[model samples]
Target: MTTTTTLKEQVLMTLKRQQANALVLYLNYKKYHWLTYGPLFRELHLLFEEQGAAVFASIDELAERSLILDGQPVADPADYLGTATVTPSSGQLTVKAMIEEAIANHELIITEMHQDADVATEAGDIGTADLYTRLVQTHQKHRWFLKELLAKGDGLVS
Candidate 1:
């Protein structure tokens, strides 16, 4: 394949993976929003809902970017679960565990976004590179928030 073709495929793959990750993350946030309890219930519930909205928006952006590159974005909910790099949480988890899970999921996406951005840059796809850069920044910010929450107090409640 030509370089342009290869780059397009790479970009599309990255976009799809990102879409999947965002979908899973959004769903996980919603889960936590509904299930979180105890001392931090109100705070964590609101935060999870807000984060869910943010991730849902990112999912739309990823799909649009894929279409802009003339690639079909995965649209089905099942597809998101199947393609996601971050696995969805199952069973019951404590509030602290939910926070830790979110942090880990963000880390997974951040690592993938960094790798995708590097590939896009090497392939001369500046737009895709920029997209990944922005995504990385967003995930990093989210990760920082989760980490800071974990850091507060004596680990019992933050």
Candidate 2:
């Protein structure tokens, strides 16, 4: 006999995945913050830290949300890697590469948040849906910042 998952179960799964991703993404941002160099070091360092903090702030909310839904979040640090769709950063990378990687990560999270929010709404979990909606705004803002940094410019209107 096949067992079907309930809507609450689906929301719980999304919450757990989001919690894991937030932790991993926060660490990745910290890595980039520490390893950044070049002329933009100061700016990039500050930006990374700010962005990292914003992502980190969401972790507790996601975990608590799981609890509110009568589900357990991914609690162990060891499980983050397995549960998160957002991969951690490693190895050496230039400033540009770091920005690119962060932008990619933000895009991934934003996409997931959009889908997850829809699922929560469908499940009548308005609270979870609102959380995802708010969190996606943050990710989108970060992505826009990184994208603008990478945008081509010649300081000419021609």
**Per-residue lDDT of 1-158 in model 2, one digit per residue for the tens?**
01488888889989999999999999999999999887778888899999999999999999999999888989988999999999899899877878888999999999999999998998999999999999999999999998888787432111
Root-mean-square deviation (CA) per prediction? 2.5, 3.5
Tens digits of per-residue lDDT for model 1 on 1-158? 24656877987888899999999899899999999888777888898888889899999899998998899999877788888889998889988889999999999999999988887888788988998898789888888888888896665543
Clash statistics: count for each candidate: 0, 0
Tell me the spans in candidate 1 whose CA falls farther than 4 Å from its real position: 1-5, 153-158
Residue 131 displacement in candidate 2 (angstroms): 0.2
Cα TM-score per model: 0.92, 0.94
Error of 1 at 68 (Å): 0.3
Model 1 alpha-carbon miss at residue 27, Å = 0.2
User: What lDDT would candidate 2 get against the real structure?
Assistant: 0.90
Worst lDDT window (10 residues) for model 2?
A: 149-158
Candidate 2 segments exceeding 4 Å error: 1-3, 153-158
Which residue pairs come into collision in candidate 2? none
